[model samples]
Structures are given as C-alpha cells and as structure tokens.
Target: MPRWTHYGSVEELMSNPLQHLCDISKKAQQHSITQNGMEEAMDYLHKLHIGDTLVTSTWKTLFAAYRAELAKLFNRIGVTLDITSNELPFGRQDLTTPIHSEILTHFLSTSEDRLDLSSSNLGTPRLHRTVASPKPLLVDLTSTLSNLKTYSRVIRIAPEKQQFTYAQHNHIVSKILSSRPTPTLLPKMETLLIAPVTDLTPLDGVLSLHTIFDQSKQHMLKFARDPNADEDTSKSETFDPVETADKLGVNAITFQILQSKRNKLLKFEWKRVMSDVRDPGVFVSYLYARLCGCVLFLSSSLSMI
Candidate 1:
C-alpha cells in the first residue's frame, strides 16, 4: 500500500475564493485548473451567498496589515484612528465573495459622518459595448479589499484572466478608498487622499500623505546625518563642470595629472547645479556654489599646467 499525503483538496481549495484567486497562475492553470476553472471558482462567490463568516484567513492576515499601515499613516498625519469592528468574521461557509459589503463598509469607514454621496459619481452606470451594465458599485464591494501584494500574488498565480482588469481594479479600489468620509475640521475643512501607484515595490500607489512625508523626512535626515555632506563642504572642492566645460568648450575633460604618476582623468562636465539637480535647500545651494568654485579653480589650474 502506498501512503499518500494530499495537499489542498479540490473542494477545500475551491472553498476559499481568495486562496483560489491567489493560486491563479499560468502554471496552476496548466497543472491543476484551467483559466475557466479559476473564473468559475470566482464566479461561484456571490455577495448573496456570503454568510456572516465571509472573511477568509487570507483576509484576516492581509486586512490586519492593511489596517495597521493605515493606522500608522493616519496617526502620522494627525488623524484619529477609529475602527468600529474589532473582530472580522471568517469560517468554512464557502462564500464565493471574499468579503461582504457590511465588512467592507466597516473597513472603508464606520463613522456616521456622511459626505453628500451626490458628489460621488458612484451613481453613474457602467457602460459595456454601448449597453449599460449593472451597477459595478453595487457589485464591487469586495474589490477594494485587494492591494498591490494580493494583485501581485494573482499575477504570479494566473497572468491571463483576472477578476479585475488593471484599470478596473484600480478604479474599484479608488472608489472604495475615496468613499471614506472626510473628517470635518472647524473653521477649515480639509481632506487627504492617498493615490495608489502602479509600481509594485514600495507601496507605490498606496502611499498615504504621512508615508510620503515620513519618507521625505527620512531622506532629509539621512543627508543631515552625513557630517561631510552639504552642511560641511569646507573640505569639498568646488567644480562647476558647466562653467569649466564652457571655458574649455567641450562636454568631456580628458587630461593627465601633472604628477610623476601621470594619471589620466576623463569626466563629463556637470551641466546642472545642485539646486537644479534637486529641490533648492539653503545649505545645498551654498555648498553647491562652493563646490562649483573649487572645481572651476582645479580645472583652471589643470588647464594652465
């Protein structure tokens, strides 16, 4: 008798829509399920069929991370974090949809504050090939639950047919994200929206205002930490490649060092100043000028020699 260890059973794999969605891949399609098989697996999940325990293990893991990140982003931007739902429901109910609208609403925004839903074009009907399609807003409640990581997983699994087209995914995600009610501030009303970037790495499109600010702050701090950086350019020689190039009338400078070793030097002229290279900072501006001057003097001396 041969002992057999089964991985995921067909029914077991099919029960979890997110897992199935994540498993979608050309290889998976070829080896286990076809493209249509995956599609059928996904279509089996309808919002109506969803029970109280609609959230999946995948949802629990990913949503936890998502909420944590969002909380940090909100905190950084001076926004209060309010989550009404402490526990997300999950189970063996075999719901086709990954999550329900109620759960999505909880995830989106649970506050009573209502923005004029009228301003939102969610009321707009989707058109398909000159015929109006069903209200995607009504059907796409679960769409916003996916993120770049999950999308990447989907692509990794099945590249051909996806539940949502790139544009469709973005659009649905954008709608769900933007549906969150804006906090009302007395005297002045302000809103912050984080745009999702298509770039797979570094949470490209999903970066919040605070995340961007924090990144910029870190970059500035990194530069600040360097003692020999712009702040202390006393030792740095100034070399305005542009001016030197103009004076020499060439894009590149190729010359031999006047020392006995006779080292050859070939370098391109620096056409852009530091300020031009990056956004202007007081220290950078001054340091760049000093560096340019040093370079020019060096070039002039070398030319004379």
Candidate 2:
C-alpha cells in the first residue's frame, strides 16, 4: 500500500519542497555500505535498514544496517533520496505524528499547563499506542539530578535480548575555551568531521559529550591519515555541538526525531578554520548539528602535510 501524494507526470515529485530528491538522483551514492571484518558483535546490523524491519514469530531485524548509513551519507553529501524515501510516517492514517512527549511534558509541568506527571502515575513502562480521551498522561520522573554524572541503561526487546546504551551518551560541555590558557610555541592544524546519526540510544544520564566526539576523531583518523604526525592540535581546534539544549534528554518520539535529523545535512557554524593539525584530541564533533537545523558541519581538523 503506497501513500500516494499526487505528483505531476512521472518526474514531478522529485522537484518538490527542497529539490534534494533531484540532487540524489544525480549522485552515485555508494559510500556507507562497507562490511566490517567478521566479529561476534553487530556486523550484520551494518547492513540493515531502519524502518524496514524483518518480522519473525518471536523477533525482528532491520534488513541492512549499512542501508541507513548509506542514507545518512547521502543526506550529508546533499543528495536528496528519491521522493518516496522522504514520505511521512503512518501513511494515509488519520493518526498523523505528534509533538515530542518528553518536551511537552516538561512544558506542561513548568509552563501554563501546570500539570505534573510523576513516576507513580506513569505505571508500568509500555505504550499501548491506544488513543484515549483527553490523552493519557506521560508518567512521572523516575530520577532527579542535582549534579553532573555518568549514567547508563540496558533495554530488552521482549522477555530478553538486552541492548546496552554503551557509548552513546550526552553531557554539558561547559565553557571550555574562555578560561585562561598558555601560549603555544608554534601553530597547529585542524579538520572538520560530521556524522549523521541514524539512530538514538534510549537512556538517561549526564554525560560529557567530549567522550563521543573524541571517539569519532579516532574512527575518522583510522580512515584518513595525515602526513604530518607531529603537529600540535591542543589550541588549534574546536568541537562544538551546534544544538545547545541545557536539559539534554529525549523520550522515544523526540529521540527518534533526533536521529532522523542527524542523517540530514545542514550548514552549521561559519567560523574561521585553523589550517594546521595542532591536536587530534582537541577536535570538535558536531553531533547535534542536524538537531539544531545546521546546513554545514564546520570543524578545524588542523594537521599539516
């Protein structure tokens, strides 16, 4: 069953909204589908699609993990997928998508609504997806934070098979560059790396975003090597998360939205770049650039040749 939105002739749909669909048509689009060396881990997922789940009696799997990665790469490179791929969710159903619950709940509690949902009211943690009158309330807060700290969660698909929210974490990267600093003896190098997030880790904790940003630089470095191995990077780089939400957390819906946007390319910060490699460890990872509606991912991967 196709959700049909009338497009003029056979080619009209590709020209709509952003003209991105047209862009992807002109591109070769074959970069994110590489197979990882065999390991007992998640190698198979490197080939799965996000939405197209494979159904079995007991469980399911997305066809190819690399598929979505391909999609994300296409997005980053300004390739608009075919018009069909951008279709809205729950096609043709009266039940269109809605606002994010976690954000709405926060607004409800603190805004004009004045209602609060506590853990006691949320009950057991499963969504029936059954619509109720005046809307069923989102449950209360399970945890409270007074200071910054690390956190983690492991989720189960059914009675078992837990998925660990391991490295996917977030935190407040406070004012880093404004403090006192000593002068360097020489100049440094830099480069910008952007990765579209096609997925989200459903967990909660105050995480130092630097953790993931640092990890990504290493991953990229594995693929891209610099000739100048001894260049300084400490003062020659910056890794800024474009979307700066003080309270960084998302429920299922908002969480998924975060991922969807991550796959889309948008121009982000248009600041000056350092043309040298000063410190690889000081590179910025623009993880939330998509979430913040950025069109370009700008970073200074400053390393000399």
Candidate 3:
C-alpha cells in the first residue's frame, strides 16, 4: 500500500524534488510512520545508492534544490522557517505528520487567483524573532504638579478651600521631610518604605485608622505613576486626591500628610513581611531609627488643636 510517485531515475527526483518528498510522505503514511521515520527512510535510501558516485551527486543536488525551493516558498509567504530541524517548518513540533502533509498539500494545491497577497493576510512585518522587554515601573515626581492640576479639575472647591488645601499639603509634607534625619536625602530616595498601620490605637477616630490606611494604600498602588509614561497618557490617568481625602474623611492638613507619606510608600509585599527578628516591634523601631530618628505624629481633629 506504498503510494509512490515513481521517478524513473535520480534525474526525475532532482527535477521535481517537492513532488518526490510529497510522494515519500504519502508512502510513509501507509506504514504509520512519522516525519522523523520518513527522514530516516530517505537517509537509508540515499545510503543504498551512496556507492554510485553519479546517484550520490544527484541526491546531494536534489536535497540542496529542495531546501532552496522551501526557503523561497516560505520567504514569499513572510515565514522564516527553521530548516535546521527536520520537522515541518510552518507549525508546532507536536503536530502530526499527516497534518503537516495536509498543510503542504493545501498550500501547493492553492490557485494564484485564490491566494490573497494583502498586507492584512500576510500579517505585519516582524523583526528576526526578537521580543521586547517590559518597561520598569518607577515614580515620576516631576509630574506631581501636573497631577495636582488634574486633581483640581475633577473636584469643585472654593478658591479659599483650594488655597488652604495647598498650604496644608505643603505644611505636612515639610514636617514629614524635616522629621527625617537626612531631610535633604528623602527627596532623592528612589523608593518609599510603606508599612501597614500595626499600631492603630493613636489615629482611632470616627473611622478606624487601619481602614483608612488600607483604602489609601490600595488607591495609591492602583494608580502608581510610571515615570517614563508620555504626558498625554499621564494626563488621562487621574488619581483624584479630593476623592481619596473624602474617603479617608481627613481634613486638608491630614489629607496632605497621608498624600506625602503615600507617595514615598512602596507597595507592601506579604512575602517580605516575615523577618528573622525575634520581635516585630524591634524591626519597626529599627526602621524608624534608620529613616526618621523620631516618631511621626498624626491628629484625628481636622482643626489643629
């Protein structure tokens, strides 16, 4: 049951290398053989005629010609075949030989009139298999003013309230910065150290301090700005400070304090929370000693009392 496209001689095989391969593939199918098995059979046949110099020379020529035609066909279709592997070039390695044979048969049987040569059909031009790496996410302090301006447009506040908010924001930010041992170095620091409000007793008010911190942390992390993002894109990506402030039920100064601290805060990872230190309080104390050298205070009252 070997299906044969019987070429009279090596000359006929060299003349129609693709057709000969197709015929061999069909013959391989009858024996329930794979592409790899078919390749071995072809190599065995080649070795049988190796003693005859003319036949050997003709086979080398035929193989070279077959490879060239395959390359040309793939190039025309905008595919770069990995011809180094003995497997079919068009599809995945897991695909059966029969599927590969069908692909080849369909491609070869297609008429010129039926073939679509449009860019959409051919797909976009791609570089030689190079994948782009993702951009790093970093804070863009430069866009802070622009972000504030965007925040202003989304909320309706009186001129006096707006001015007071700005003053309050600045004052809290100044206190937070000034409290740091190296106050000048805080602005230059690339990343913020954020921790959960473990000691929530101090700020407990109408709303739980822990709840407010968690909400603010979630909001801050959700819209964390990319330093490299374009201006137009950043403009559209708004994190309304007013809305965040309202949610926390904080006044202008407290809202500013949270905003300033939140900006410097890094995304907290649970994996990193576990430490070798015997006491968690000791770790917190160490961080405080290293960063601020003093306890940062917060008041529940909106009006400074």
> Against the true structure, what is each candidate's TM-score?
0.19, 0.21, 0.18
The TM-score between candidate 1 and the true structure equals 0.19
lDDT per residue as tens, model 1, 203-275: 3222122222223323333433442444434445433322222212111111111110221221211222221
Instruction: Give the per-residue lDDT digits (tens) of candidate 3, residues 1-305.
Output: 12232423343333223444545545555667764565554554343221111111122233333333333222332333332223221222222234333433433343431223322223222221222641111111111212222211111112222222334434433433343343333442112212122222322122223333444444334434442243333344443332222222222224433333223222222122223232223222222111110011122111221
Question: lDDT per residue, candidate 2, 76-98, as tens digits?
Answer: 32223221221211011111112
Instruction: After superposing candidate 3 on the true structure, give the runs of residues whose Cα lies further than 4 Å from its correct spot.
Output: 1-8, 34-37, 44-101, 104-305
Of 1 and 3, the candidate ahead on lDDT is 3
Model 2 C-alpha lDDT versus the unseen true structure: 0.21
**lDDT (Cα, 0-100) at 240 in candidate 3:** 38
Relative to the unseen true structure, what is the C-alpha lDDT of residue 161 in candidate 2, on a scale of 0 to 100?
Answer: 14
Instruction: Look at candidate 1 and tell me the lDDT of residue 231.
Output: 41
* TM-score for candidate 3, residues paired by index: 0.18
Task: Please give the lDDT score at residue 143 for candidate 1.
Answer: 28
- Candidate closest to the true structure, highest lDDT: 3
Clashes of each: 14, 43, 1
Query: For this target, which candidate reaches the highest TM-score against the unseen true structure?
Result: 2
